[model samples]
Each structure stands twice: as C-alpha cells, then as structure tokens.
Target: MDRAEVTELVLSAKRMKGLTWKDIHEKVSVSTSPIVVTAALLGQMRLEPNEAAKAAELFGLPEEAQILLTEIPYRGSLTEIPPTDPLIYRFYELVMVYGTTWKELIQEEFGDGIMSAIDFDMTMERQPDQKGDRVKLQMSGKFLSYKRY
Candidate 1:
C-alpha cells in the first residue's frame, strides 16, 4: 500500500483504540519520533525484524502490506505538523515532556548532541502499575555530536 492507504489502515486498527502516540513512545527502546512508530502501523514503514513481527501479530497486516512496509517510503506529514503527522507527533510529545532529562543524560553520556535514530537500538517492556500497565522503553543510539568532533 502507498502512504495514504497505509495511513488509513494504521488509524483504523482495533488495537489502536484509546492509544495515543504517547503510549507508543514510552514502549520504545530508542529516541525515535512517534510518527515513525504509528506510521509503521500503516504497513507503509519498515520496522526492525522483531518489531515487524510484533506488529504483524498485533495488526494482522496482509502480506503485501508487510512487504511494502519494508521498502523505504516517500515520507510525509499528514497535517501541518513539523516532521509530524499524527503518528510522529506522539514521539515528539515525549521529547517535549521529558526532553530535559534526555538532553541532560545524553550530554552526560556523550556530549551536546543527539543520537542517530537511524542507527539505534531499542527495547520495550510492560510493567504492571497500580493505575495501569506501564511501558518501559530502553533505547541506545550511537550519539552524534551536534558539532564537529
């Protein structure tokens, strides 16, 4: 499927009920935009093998949709959002909320720069909480220096 078709499919999933991009963000293991994750639901975006597998089970994407997702896509923002449509915006929210901590920690670990989401690794877990199930995201990316090193 193309971008439009995929976007629709992602937004239409029963599993997606009551889920916001924020919920998905906390379940990741790396610094990626929620757009990337939510867009993946459309079967238009590529996912890591394990991630793809998980999505397949969760969303029941058709075989073609699965294949199409693995191919690099012509990316776009569904709305007037910056590098964001609906899917990616969820990830941006995390950065906006916990960005200070992330910025500080990355600076402490590497320096003043951001990590490469393209060359990153992430893992997620679900923990039972008093209020609800909490998602634990653990991510490690090869940090890139904002300036010439």
Candidate 2:
C-alpha cells in the first residue's frame, strides 16, 4: 500500500479503537515527543523499524504498512499552498503577517542563519486564563549559520 493508504488505514484503525494521538503515543512509547510520533503515523515523518513495529502493534497495521512507516516521507506535501483548513490557515496567516518580522529578529540575533526544522522540538499545552483558555506552543530548533566560501 502507498503511504497515503497506510495513513488512511491507520486513521481508520485509530477511530475503530477510539484511540487518541496521546493514547497511541503512550502505548507505543517509542519517541519522547508525541508530536514526532504523531507526524510519523500521519505519513509526514519516518520511524525506526522497532518504532514502526510498536506503532503497527498499537494500530493493528499490517507488515507492509509498518514497513512504510519506516520509510522517509515527503514532508509538507499534504497541505495546499494557502492551507484550506481554518486551523492550518491561521498558521499560514501567522507567517504572512509576521514572517518578515521573525526573519529580521532572527537575523539580528543569530546572524545569517535559519532554524532547522529537521532538528526541532515543539510542545503544546493549554494555559488557564480567567476569561478563556489559551493555547501555548513552545518550539525549539537548532540554528544553522550560512557558510561563506
């Protein structure tokens, strides 16, 4: 099966079993980061063989699907240019509004460098607020400087 098919099968299995991402992540317990592991199941990232086996067991996936999980995926391929989903579109909007500001700030602080998504970690949590709850996200990525030849 293709990676997309495997992903669909995984989603179906997750629904049938009433499994949350957290539930699967906890059951597999392979990666420290839930986000990374979730990305792997969503067909955006690759898992190690052992990790794939664990995920397969948890999701009742076949061996072929488990093997596909261990293969590198075409990252950022699923989303449209503008991202049609409302929640996803908000992220695109954030870039459109603040991207230049972020670029300027990063350049000023780090000097001709960019953050590495390949070596990144992110956490999301809910913040208790009096009026309403807030979503808090923390992202940390390694900075790579441009090399001058």
Candidate 3:
C-alpha cells in the first residue's frame, strides 16, 4: 500500500480503538518524544525496524504498513499553502507576524545563521493560568552559522 493508504488504515485503527497519540507512543515505546512518534505514524517521519514493528503491533497494522512506517516520508507534503485548518492557520499567522522579529533577534544574538529543523526538539505543555489554560511550546533547534567562503 502507498503511504497515504497506510496512513488511512492507521487513522481508522486508531479511531476504532479510541487511542490517543500518547497511548500509541507509550504502548509502542518507539521514541521518548510523543510528538516524534506521532509524526512517524502520521507519515511525516521514519521509524526504525524494531520501532515500526512495535507500532504495527499496537495499531494492529499489517506487515506492509509496518514496512511503510520504516520508510522515509515526504515531510510537510500535506500542508496547505495558507493552512485552511484553524489551528494550523494560527501557527502560520504566528510566523507571519513574528517572522521578522524572530529573525532580527536571532541574527543579533547568534550572527547570520538559521535554526536547523532537522536537529530540533520541541515540547508542549499546559501552563496553569487563572484567565485560561495556556499552551506552552518550547522548541530547541541547533543554530547553524553561515560559513565564510
């Protein structure tokens, strides 16, 4: 089956089993980070063979799907240009609003360079607030400075 088909199967099984991404991540014991493991299952990342096998067992996926999980996926291939989804759109909006500010601050602090998404780690937590529960996101990525040629 194609990656998209496998994704569909996985989503179907997850829904039928009433499983959360955390549930699958912990049960499969694939990665320490739930986000990474979830992304692998959602066809954005690759899992090692052993990890893929464990995920297959947890999700009741077939052999082909398990193999597909181990294959490298086309990351960010499914994103819409402007992001039609509200939650995703908010993230897009954040970048649009803060993109320059972030760039300027980073450049000033770290010189001319960029953050490496390939070598990144992120965490999401709920911050307790009397006004409302706030979403706290912490992202750490390696900084790659430009090389003088």
Top TM-score: which candidate number?
A: 2
- lDDT against the true structure, per candidate, is 0.64, 0.89, 0.88
lDDT tens readout by residue for model 2, 43-148: 8988888889898998888999999999999888745789898998898999999999989999999999999998998999999999999999998889999999
Give one digit per residue, the lDDT tens place, for model 1 in 1-149. 57566556656664466656666444532455665676565543566655554444445666665556566776544555454566577787877899999889879988778888778766667899999998788887888888664
How much is the lDDT of residue 136 in candidate 1? 85
- Tens-digit lDDT track of model 3 for 30-125: 445888888888888888899889888977889999999999898896457899999988999999999999999999999999999999999999
Q: Tell me how far the alpha carbon of residue 119 in candidate 1 is from the true structure, in angstroms, after superposition.
A: 1.4
- The TM-score values for the models, in the order shown, are 0.51, 0.95, 0.94
The C-alpha local distance difference test score for the whole of candidate 1 amounts to 0.64
The global Cα lDDT (0 to 1) of model 3 is 0.88
Rank candidates by lDDT, best first. Answer: 2, 3, 1
